[model samples]
Target: MRTRTNGIQLLRNGERSVDKQYRGQRIFERLGNVSQAEAEDWLKQRQAAVDAQHANQLREGDEQLFAAAAAKYLTECQQRGVRTLETISYHVQILLPYIGGMRLRDVCNDSLEAFKDARVTEDGVKNITVNRSLEVVRTVLNRAARVWRTNGKPWLSTSPLIEMLDEKGQERPPRPISWGEQAGLISRLPAHLQRMVLYTVNTGARDDNVCGLRWDWEVPVPELQRSVFVIPSEHYKGKRPHVQVLNDVAWSVVQECRGMHDDYVFVYRRERVKNVEDEPVMPYDRIDTMNNTGYQAARKAAGLVGVRIHDLRHTFGQRLREAGVPEEDRALLLGHAIEGMPQHYATSTIARLVDLANSVTQTRDRTTLLRVING
Candidate 1:
């Protein structure tokens, strides 16, 4: 007897049979008829041939090669603009030496674990440094897996294999200078650095802003009736241009520094102008170098410890808060992005900010007067 199995006729000869179509063709040609057993045997052989072909493809593990995948992954990263050339260079320089030759299929939990351990103990690097390097590697591999999935290839299956060391590496909190300390430090600093520190403290402007100050960027806001320093986007870390108000103290510093240079607005030892190439030379560089050297000397002279240049800005913020200036207004003066529900309120002018800053002294005077009268 013969029956249909998956659209092909199965037959039995002694132990196998030929397909009916083959038998038909044979009979038509006056050849011997094929038995059912022969047809069944031929079907099994065809299936076996397909299975062997698939097994051969499985053995050929060329797709998951690490070097090729990493190269292609880097190309994709560049194309997508996800990472910059400098950043990619760092990852390649640091990470490639460790796992560059390993195949993707060969990567396992133990391999990643060993790499992490070796990075810390063998290299004697900090845990934070090792963590950063591992993060780059993991990101690249995961990106590769994403690309593979899009192409309908087998996933790398090792994204979850890597583990990061648990260490929170954050910068230390800003240690602000007290009012008395600030005044003493300022008095002890050289004339140029004294102005810089005073300006930074009074206006809450960043070091870069004060250092990069130029006369061309100053603009007068009619509403505030005061001139403000307009910082260009290129010079700012936030990549946004901002207007900073110079207070009475800040204006005094600016006026004093004005005699130094009409063009640069600040200068140190008056280097003779040689050519047009010297036009964009930063005036604050010399002043800052002098300031740093003088600051250390001053710190030693005053017997103070742990005083940094940045503490001036922090001191400004802390003083504003202590003076009862509204937090929103303080953030605006400090050039911090406003947040929360109060950001919708009307924007205050520079004059108002100056007034608020002055109010701190007045409030203290009023409290002192009340205490004296009660006593």
Candidate 2:
């Protein structure tokens, strides 16, 4: 029996099948013992799949541009909730001016020479910085060739080799600051920044984690009479949840920050603009980064040149080692990736970590072996 829906019919044996021709293609689907509506739905789905496959085949051809592939890569990254989407987008924007118009197949190492030269000479960026941009380009091209497929045809024939610039001599060693240097740098910074720096040095949390720290991540441990921030896997660099164990000094800083902001732990109070919307000025606003204009001015005034925000984390790790804390404890305190270790920590373990962290607080007893070499 033929249904009103085209290409859907009931067989003599009470079976149903969809026999349809879509876009110059035959789609024959046998849906067993199904109703006319089911046959119709099957036909609709099959035809849609065929249409999409055809569209993909048409789109992912030799005419594909680097910009188009980059857009697709970024969309996939955003959909997957990639933590470094903003950084990737920045690299894409830098690449677009050079390879936006270039065909996917044409974006080889040879073609990238001009962009590399421009970045090194015109932009005055280091080879390592240029390498980061190149790495993004390599990632996009690799995804296009290996992952993205259209009608069994890959987006590109092959991903070309992207040579990274040698960073042997250009590499800068970690500058772990001394306690005296820390005092000078901390005193020069603003109150909000000062708290953040202290928090970072105590916890060894990265700049992003420090800046994005929320009150909600804090889990109170009444047994220990303290709280620790539990960073979700999505928010952390290691793709695993990190427990931000606070020592006595870090806990003290946290106490000072309590009731300051409902959302963020550290925040700055900016002066209200004349015609802008009036917002609450009591709790202040979330700080984007500790490496802002105020931080730069403070560092300069304090004569702490070439000192990056990341050095605070280095200082923490250095101090922990100097305090004679165990290597495994240092790894956990610094949030370093430990294989086969569970994310959730017991109260006892938390207490032990807190003790290890406190050892660094009293820098007076620790050796000052960190030589300050300004770049």
Candidate 3:
């Protein structure tokens, strides 16, 4: 005998039977009484109910569930090899204070616009700072969308809140140090730092490159005869290898610094040193001490008002132009990438760089330079 109850069919298996209650529903079975057909039908119905429930939950458009998206985005950033952990952490901190609890879907264009306005007017933030903050938000959201797409979810198509801020009309005022000022500043610095300052002024090398210089990296090529600082790609701002030719003055500075620090080229301790086992150690205090006392006192004594340590780099570019070096050569010496070439283009040889620096030094008449300085 067979019986149909709530669309389930049961058959008698010779003589035994059992009754079961599941989820407020009663079911009956006998030994071999419930056919495979009946089991299949029940499973299909249960699955359909589950699917319907899921569809309803998704339709609610709740953002609370997407909190994990930010964490996933941060993990992805770490994997992508972001060099500055402090910079990334700062960006994350700024965004979290503003929208940490908000869902990805809740962050629309309007919300972002309001945030920008608040940052600029209310917080008195600079445009560049605000621009960077927006970039952090945009990167995270874009990463989230990508992760969702990779996981086969279609809920997110793109980041809705972030876009480039228009900067077509804004122009920055020129801020290069004058040649007379450079000479005065150079004269005031201690004999040790004078060469470093000159090299920085001539080549526009950043503070780190100037201070972090090492002797082993200084190679004297036969053709050039003069030693050149070979900045490894990893240490360079462009993340590419480059060679900076040292002029007579700059090379003299290197030699002097070499005498002071036997192992390292520069006197200041390198930020992030390595031990005998070749593990990186924390940055030392020497560089900061040099910057605050020695560098600052020299600048003040020189009477070079409004000058910064980095102004030497600007002076380098300006002096290059004054010396009649072409724009292309100037850009090359500054370690900037030329259009149509990759960032890692071969750097100028030590001889050529020396010639270029010497040309700038030779062209200016000392008497005329004095007249300008006196004026």
Q: What is the C-alpha lDDT of each candidate?
A: 0.62, 0.86, 0.62
Q: lDDT of model 1 at residue 346? A: 26
Answer with 2 or 3, whichever has the higher TM-score. 2
Candidate 3 residue-wise lDDT, 292-347, digit = tens: 56678888898765567766776677677778888876776788877754333233
Compose the digit string of candidate 1's lDDT tens values, residues 1-375. 435543243334323333333322321111135554555556666666666545443432334445555666677767765414445657566666667656666655566677777777888877767777677666666765554663465456445456767665534456666656666787887776787788888877776677668888877666655577777666665656666766677777887876566655555663455664666654543343323577788877765556566766776777777788888878767778644422222225567766775553332223233325534
Over all chains combined, what TM-score does candidate 2 have? 0.79
TM-scores, all candidates, are 0.50, 0.79, 0.61
For model 3, the local distance difference test gives: 0.62
lDDT of 2 by residue, 156-199 (tens): 88889999998887878788777877889899987888999999
Which pairs clash (backbone N, Cα, C closer than 3 Å) in model 2?
Answer: none
